[model samples]
Target: MALGTNTGGGGVGAGTEVPALSGAPLLGSLHDLKSDSLGTYLRAQQRHGDVVRVSAGPPGMRADLYCVFSPEGVQQVLASEAANFRKDNAFYQEVRESFGNGLLTSQDEDYLRQRRLVQPLFTRRRVDGYAGAVAAETASVVTAWEEALDGVVDVSDEMTHLALRAVARILFGTDVEATAEVVARCFPVITEYVLRRGYSPANIPRSWPTPGNRRAAAAMDELYGVCDRIIGQRRRAGADASGEDLLTLLAAARSPDDGGFDAAELRDQVLIFLLAGHETTATSLCFALHLLARHPEQQDRAREEITRVLGGRPAQARDLERLPYLSQVVKEAMRLYPAAPVIGRKAVAATRIGGHAVPAGADVILAPWVTHRRPEHWPDPDRFDPERFTPEAEAGRPRYAWFPFGGGPRACIGQHFSMLESVVALAMILRAYSFEAVDTEIPVGAGITLRTEGPARCRIRRLDGPVGPR
Candidate 1:
């Protein structure tokens, strides 16, 4: 399989099609893709090699997909020659129904403009400042857990709440406990509807009065209504509004080309930030804690590092560098279960990948969940080992091999923020509590992000002092 150079942004029909992974007649692989997306991708890659054409969607009429699982293929689709690939695919088009033209769903010029506008919000200094908020939120959750010591807790749910609160504090500059509660209730509805549309080959239009669509519409209304209330209240407060939050910044920012983000655009970006921001980070943290619980030795190693570094003090932004093992644990957990498991892009121009012809309008899937676990890139791919992410070990691997936050120019803008938040949260939690895995079998599911099928249950024990020995 030879790599193809980008041949300008021009559309061309697929020259030589790759072999197809056989699935049910007419349905093709849609059911498999929707049912067990992770298993389907891994199985396809194992059977058909790295790049296989997936015959999904309607019987014909250009519903073919090229699933790319190799690191080289991932780099091509996500980074190099990314301009030829667009987010204007079926999945993203449906996502835009709820997300609007936010960074997650927007493409091309609009995407570039949005990226430029929002990038500054996540600069190193800005993300560094968020560490304090992340630590504080984690500490708050820890305090709550202290009351419930010896009780079983849903780690996933708690992480979700913690993430929402942290993002609320960082992005809104005020506590949105009430708003977060509303989102926590309604966002799942939006996720359920959007996930169905994203994975299903034949999706009912949102305009149709289907029961699912009706529920989705109501959920969007409620979710957006919450945003409206927050923004509305801020507007009413005017000068009293916190001048440093992302919402305030967006309200003030104006673009010469598009005249800046209007009310609708503001709502879209804020909703995306609130929804995407909390969920992915929460998912990653949940998996990290679950992994640590499963491996007590590794957990002890991390806790020991945190105890020695802080010497009984809570984790803060300045203490990150001193906590290398904790960082490795976070990276390894993300490798096993990347938050954004699959990245989808549609080809706007004709291209060749792995010596096979890829035509315009083909949906390209770059799945880290599959690629990260590839034996070539990772040894004992299923094992939970943080040593793989050590500085010495990471230098030998490809940049895209373990991208939990993604890669390339269009990689997650909140990558730094997520990492800082996760590490700080993990360190703080380890300082106060040690989790024991209550459910040995944790089921994986696919939604907006890779998610747990049910609440990841863990037994919590509050630590009296240092995690090591006494």
Candidate 2:
């Protein structure tokens, strides 16, 4: 409990010791840290040893915080002893209010059943089916950019638009133009309320008449109305067997034991897809573009690889295997600026992590933001270095050293789809334009997904001539 005193190392063997911090602060001061939450945690790790404790919020509602810096400690939390943790109750409690029993927020049997039904839809073969749609969408977006008048463009906003459109097409077979508009209008409300709930837990009572809460309620209603209409039309048209779009797949997905998703469950799942399918990918795409703009050498290298693979044509799924460097760029970007920086869990039972005893009901926080950039695992962790992810380099590191999508059975189910979309989109954008960041510092804001605090202003002009191949 003393600040700066080393807590005895938690693990059994030598070097596995959790270094104690003497008189280390229990929680970090939000004001002094970088706006980026992950950066803040990483800074905390520097001052407090790897397994520092944190005071949650106000007294009486306080929760225990555990920051896992070592790969072994992270693997133990995420993989080896996964069941000891559940999605942080406070976080999921808010998600349940909006998403119901959707896979992202659900736990235990409900989570397992939903995951099983949805897993097949993301298989290599199934996700590969989305290649054409992904490429076409990327092409369409790039074409628009190519035609734009010369000026500064907010690539973050643009990528958000593109990602939502792409996910919409993959999920419901709707065109980007239509779904993007709907998502744009509804997203702010969802984001605002979720953040408010996260920060001020006591203000989330159902009976609260706050304007933000009311707006959130209204947005949910509008979203549900849209989803219901979509579902109704699909059912009435007897389109259940027509295609493998997520809607059709979910409409037909049955729990082998129990029938299929009930009316409410189906609605929740669709909402989850609409939100998770788009938001996280959009954040990642924005950050990737932001990184690319700042690191022109890395950007040019990725573009070179893309051109070598596909010439001047659009990239396809088949090309992903050949575009290892481009994939590594995306992976590195996610490592530095993961869409979801912090993943939390609540102990369902008493557990020991990093050799420290965690009592039942204790809140456990695992931040990829802190772990991914730890200097111990990554050299010059802040630098934009894609080489670290190359096959040889990756093989040398522990599995949990760079978990942006998360790890274990509860990892992001749409990870494969997201990766494919990012690679193709990166290829399209690089082929069309050369982008540069307007400033050295790109501000990040964290909501349901991590995003730029303001527009990621960049100068995007059509490339004057063909760049050489990879």
Candidate 3:
């Protein structure tokens, strides 16, 4: 089925009700839903067509939410009528403590203003320039893995470390490792706390001195301390006008209308960047490597391509276009396991998605996790097939069918930066090492991002000699 039955623009007609997916009258689907929410949503979508209404929260206070699994329904909410959707949903409420009014949590004019300010920092040329830095950081990670090749290495941990280093290099030019350690230490705590609260029926007010709340507060404080110290140092040294690192550019940036970011605003933006910048790409790379490890034929094919294209040199920005198979592998991995598995938006005004009425303040979830696996859109939905992303194949699919980075204007600002980072990092690492999956089946769970339940272990064996012509 493609989305809803009706294609008309106006909201679902009066008396026409989109059937609700069966659940406990009071508890609804709450019992069935677990940390592996992606699996729950996928099963629900298979049973109940495109749009399924489900209940959440505790008994009397249960909240009704809609999950849109159809590409057309997703497109309507994310692109066509996006103005009716706001970012201040339950999820954002949980995250606001950490994100503040930064781009990720802010809505309306504040969001637009911040977007304008940060826009210049991620231009095509600017992101391309970071390829050299990304390549260098990725090489450092591969070299470090040389000693641990004899034991099972946690690709998840390694990717997280590598991604943190890459983003830190891009954000803070000099003290990269030290800055990344601070981010690595605090981000997991803050993100986990926020996600735990987002799903809880009874909420603990942040002001309360509960132990969990206190721990979350301390993490936030440490995060702020680190951001403050670095930004303070940059300000004291005078902003580097020509510098390409995010800190320098943000510190130097002065909007013609609203002026520059104040201390608090700087902290908020940096927190969002630090948390979001590394985490999504890390999750993507982890999944990509895991998938490649499981499919040795595909891994060998990728290695062959890398050898042909790169000779023995580390992957650079110019080499990206030539490595089509590597790009497909990454894209397909994201299709199977999108980092941001579930995206939530609240309706600001009564509207419709797929002709189903959505009341104001109601939360609508668009899950790439569900849509990407919908059997109607993807044949053999569970199969690991990178060929699905080939140019000709992609040309036949719906536009919103594979939006791992999301869609429309509110989509991830760092999409280009992320793609470049993944492609470069994967190429550099794959060329130098061959990974064997230690566990064929790894459990999936949802925290702030899609994650593995335990460490995704892989055995690595280094390729003899250099990978390409340097």
Give the best candidate by lDDT. 3
Worst 10 residues of 3 by lDDT: 1-10
Ranking by lDDT: 3, 1, 2
Clashing pairs in 1: none
Instruction: Give the residue spans of candidate 3 off by over 4 A.
Output: 1-15, 239-243, 467-470
Candidate 2 error regions (>4 Å): 1-36, 147-149, 175-178, 239-241, 464-470
CA lDDT of 410 in candidate 3?
93
lDDT of 3 by residue, 263-315 (tens): 88888888788778888999999999999999999999998998899877778
Please tell me which model should have the higher lDDT, number 1 or number 2.
1
Candidate 3 lDDT score at position 284? 92
lDDT against true structure, model 3 = 0.81
Q: How far is candidate 1 from the true structure (C-alpha RMSD, Å)?
A: 4.2
Q: After aligning candidate 2 to the native by TM-score, how far in Å is the CA of 147 from where it should be?
A: 4.2
Tell me the deviation in Å of residue 362 in model 3: 1.3
* The best candidate in terms of TM-score: 3
Quote each prediction's TM-score. Answer: 0.92, 0.89, 0.94
Instruction: Give Cα-based local distance difference scores for all models.
Output: 0.80, 0.72, 0.81
Off by over 4 Å in 1: 1-16, 58-62, 236-240, 255-259, 466-470
